[model samples]
Target: MSVRPIGTDDEALERAALRDRHLDRARTRGAVEDAERRHRAEKDAAAGEHGIHDVT
Candidate 1:
């Protein structure tokens, strides 16, 4: 086998951590979007039951 430097493992770990951060951000964004959609749907339903229309 060939000899390798000691810092290679650290580099790999850093890359993995960066990737995890990106994935976390993406998941958080998706959750927020889903929550907003649900809130909007509920609001619209409530407005409809009261015979209200959105002016904007």
Candidate 2:
């Protein structure tokens, strides 16, 4: 089996780190948005069951 180094240069390492950070932020944002969406859906459903329509 042949093994290769993960990064060849400092620039490559910096770029990879930046990309990872961006991905982490994106994942966090997505999780927050998903939670917000679920909360809104549940709230709307609860209001609907009580014969109330949320205008907002």
Candidate 3:
């Protein structure tokens, strides 16, 4: 195994915290995107558009 020194507790904790925060924001953004997709589908359907391949 490599002999690199282990990081301090605070440094590891900070990195983990940052990673968690980023993941949380990504999840939130994904949810918003899903809702937007649904809204767009409904709007398109109202206008007589069908299928994701509709280009007009």
Candidate 4:
């Protein structure tokens, strides 16, 4: 592999770490949204079984 200067290496490492953090946050947000959607659907289904319907 080609050798990079110390500063360049540090910059690259920092950028990679930042990118990873951003990706992790996005993944976590997507998971939470999915779980919320599923929970809402289940709650609505249960309400419907009791003859309740959401107006909004």
Candidate 5:
């Protein structure tokens, strides 16, 4: 059996942690965009029912 050096382990762990953070940010951005779209759609639908709009 063979074991890798400690420096290599640190580099691998750091790379994995950075990747995980990036993925988390991407996922959060996507969720936020989806929520905003849903909210806007609902708001527009409600406004239409009440005939209230900027009408530009």
Candidate 6:
């Protein structure tokens, strides 16, 4: 495989930056979804303890 010299390619730098940004966004989204899921589960458990039924 041929290795291109770093700091000499503008297009490669831009593509790498874009890829990093996309990965960061995906990680953030997954964290948020996980937090929401845990919160919902806890809320459901609490309601169940009190004999409350979720309508939705």
What is the overall TM-score of model 5 with all chains considered together? Answer: 0.46
**Best prediction by TM-score:** 6
Candidate 2 TM-score, true structure as reference: 0.48
Candidate that beats the other on lDDT, 1 or 2, i.e. the better one = 1
Per-residue lDDT tens digits for candidate 5, residues 1-56, read: 99867678789999999999987887777965787889989988999999988465
Quote the lDDT for 8 in model 4: 79
Which pairs, if any, clash in model 5? none
TM per prediction: 0.49, 0.48, 0.45, 0.46, 0.46, 0.49
- Any residue pairs clashing in model 1, and if so which? none
Collision count of model 2: 0
Score each candidate by Cα lDDT.
0.88, 0.88, 0.81, 0.88, 0.85, 0.87
Question: lDDT score, residue 52, model 1?
Answer: 98
Which lDDT tens digits does candidate 3 get at residues 1-56? Answer: 88987898999999999999987887777975787889988888876754445566
How many residue pairs clash per model?
0, 0, 0, 0, 0, 0
* lDDT by residue (tens digit), candidate 6, 1-56: 99867665887889999999987897777975787889999999999999999999
Looking at model 4, residue 39 earns an lDDT score of 99
**Model 1, 1-56: lDDT tens per residue?**
99878678789999999999987887777975787889999999999999999898
Global CA lDDT computed for model 6: 0.87
Clashes of 3: 0
The residue ranges of model 5 lying beyond 4 angstroms of the native Cα positions read 1-29, 54-56
Residue 7 CA displacement from its true place in model 1, Å: 41
